[model samples]
Target chain A: MFVILVYDTAAERNPTVLMTCRRYLHRTQRSVFQGELTAAQYRELTSALSTAIDPEYDSIVTYTARSPGMIDSTTIGVHLGGPGDIL
Target chain B: MFVILVYDTAAERNPTVLMTCRRYLHRTQRSVFQGELTAAQYRELTSALSTAIDPEYDSIVTYTARSPGMIDSTTIGVHLGGPGDIL
Candidate 1:
């Protein structure tokens, strides 16, 4: 399975969380990681990484796909700005 | 593009935002929406939806996959529970 994590500036502070995440998942690029694992393994890896994260520094969004067909093809974004930002 | 909105109780309250989202995207199932749109269209839709959302009631996570190969294959989860929830 593949897991993608996108973090705002705050999330970058926790080195330990990033390190542990790197240990289990292959870092495909900066701030993005990927790997194929069974259900059990996926659970185990994410579970461990979550604890090491500091909630104050990070807001994480994880996306999991069992099959390529199930993937979402749109550009998903969260607007962290003011109400007027939406147009 | 496929966008999945998973709400942790609070996100369900904003009917207006949900309605707007439904109007633009095809609701594939409960809380999940799918459709194929150009980059400009996707941005416009999500931009509008973000404004009507109430921050206290919801935390939104959006995943956009342009191609099937970029999709993550792992089971992505967030443990909102206590620290020990990690195993």
Candidate 2:
């Protein structure tokens, strides 16, 4: 399945969170990440994130789309980042 | 369609971004928003966000799901917020 993961962590922990996500997904926005991942990879990604952030105040939400074709994205202003093929 | 909007803006502009999102979607995370909306409402959301943010730096990405039923979400850490019904 394809997943869109959005996170909000403390400024100091943000780098760790972003690095973990980049290992499995594309950094489509400063706080948003998306890409295809198998169920196992998704589990791994979540597991890594759980350790990288402080749940007490940090927030990470994952939205799953059954398939890549199911996702439709739009950019409102300047494109920050996205899949290489789409760019 | 159901929409998930994620934003990353300067601290000074964050409130404007969140407020605009709240007008049309349920904020499910510190920087992420999601909800079902008519096509027109979606248009309005993009317009308001466009006017409220600085494209040169602010990043806003919208993901569209054909239907609300199609969205599957997972929270790895403590939930910060979500739709009132789901809460």
Candidate 3:
């Protein structure tokens, strides 16, 4: 599944959550990551995230695109690293 | 269609692009916006974005979710505005 993961954690745990996500996905911007993953990888990611966040505090939203090119994206300003980075 | 729009514009035009997007979608973060847009709305947004950005420089990527709930999302930090807001 291709996913766009957006997260917001307490200030103290920001690094931990950010690092964990960076290990699995591309850090497009602060608290935002996106890339492809298999069901297993997704499960693993969710598991790690669940432990990193407090249910009553932090929030993470993941959008799973239906297909590879299903996402119609546009670029406006400076180019940061993106899907083009990998294959 | 449901879409997640991410953009990275030049430092100078950032505000213009951000405000344009905010008019059509929710500002999930600094440059990330997501919401449901009709085909017409999507076209309009693209048109506006194209005019707002310099293709040679800026980049905007729009991910259209297959279905309303097809996107399985999770929240971790502070819940800014979301799908639950208007609908």
Candidate 4:
């Protein structure tokens, strides 16, 4: 499946959250990550994030599609990084 | 179509971007927003955001699906506000 993960966490927990996500997805831009993941990997990613963040202030969301092509994404602005660069 | 928009912008421009998105979508978290939009509304949103952000440092991304169910979403931690609460 293709998943896009977006997160906003407390300043002190940002590093941990960022690092955990980078381990599984491409850092398309600050606070945004996306890539393909198997069911197990997807479960693992969310679990790691749940453990890294403070439930009171941090929020993380994942949007999944059956495949990358199923999602219509548009980016307006300079490219930072991510799977979007592939032609 | 159902659209999910996420943005990371320079501090000073955050308010403008946030307000613009709020007019068209539900604020799902600090940096994420999602709602259903007509093609005209989607175009207007991208245009508004493009004018509000500094391309060199800010990025705005939109993900669209045929229907809300086409994209499976999972949220961890507190949701600031959004359409997610509906039964």
lDDT winner: 4
By DockQ, the better pick of 1 and 4 is 4
What share of the reference contacts survives in each candidate?
Answer: 0.20, 0.79, 0.64, 0.85
Alpha-carbon lDDT, every model: 0.49, 0.85, 0.74, 0.87
Name the weakest run of 10 consecutive residues (lDDT summed) in model 1 chain B.
Answer: B78-87
Question: Which candidate has the highest DockQ of all?
Answer: 4
Model 4 per-residue lDDT tens digits across residues B1-87: 999998989899999998899888988878889999999999999999999999988998899987888899888997777676322
Task: Tell me the lDDT of candidate 1.
Answer: 0.49
Q: Sort by TM-score, best first: what order?
A: 4, 2, 3, 1
Model 3, position B84, has a per-residue lDDT of: 52
- What 10-residue stretch in candidate 4 chain B is worst by lDDT? B78-87
Error of 4 at B63 (Å): 1.0
TM-score-better candidate, 2 vs 3: 2
Q: Per-candidate TM vs. native?
A: 0.41, 0.89, 0.71, 0.91
Candidate 4 local lDDT, A1-87, one digit each (tens):
999999989999998998888788987768889999999999999999999999888899899998988888888887778665422
lDDT per residue as tens, model 1, B28-54:
323434444567877787677666566
Q: Per-residue alpha-carbon lDDT of model 3 for B1-87, expressed as tens digits? A: 887887767799898988788788887654567888898998899899989898887777777755567676555556666755432
Give all candidate RMSDs, comma-separated.
11.5, 2.7, 3.6, 3.0
Instruction: Place model 4 in a CAPRI quality band.
Output: medium
Two-chain complex of model 4, DockQ on C-alpha atoms against the true structure: 0.77
| Rank ordering of all candidates by lDDT, starting from the highest | 4, 2, 3, 1
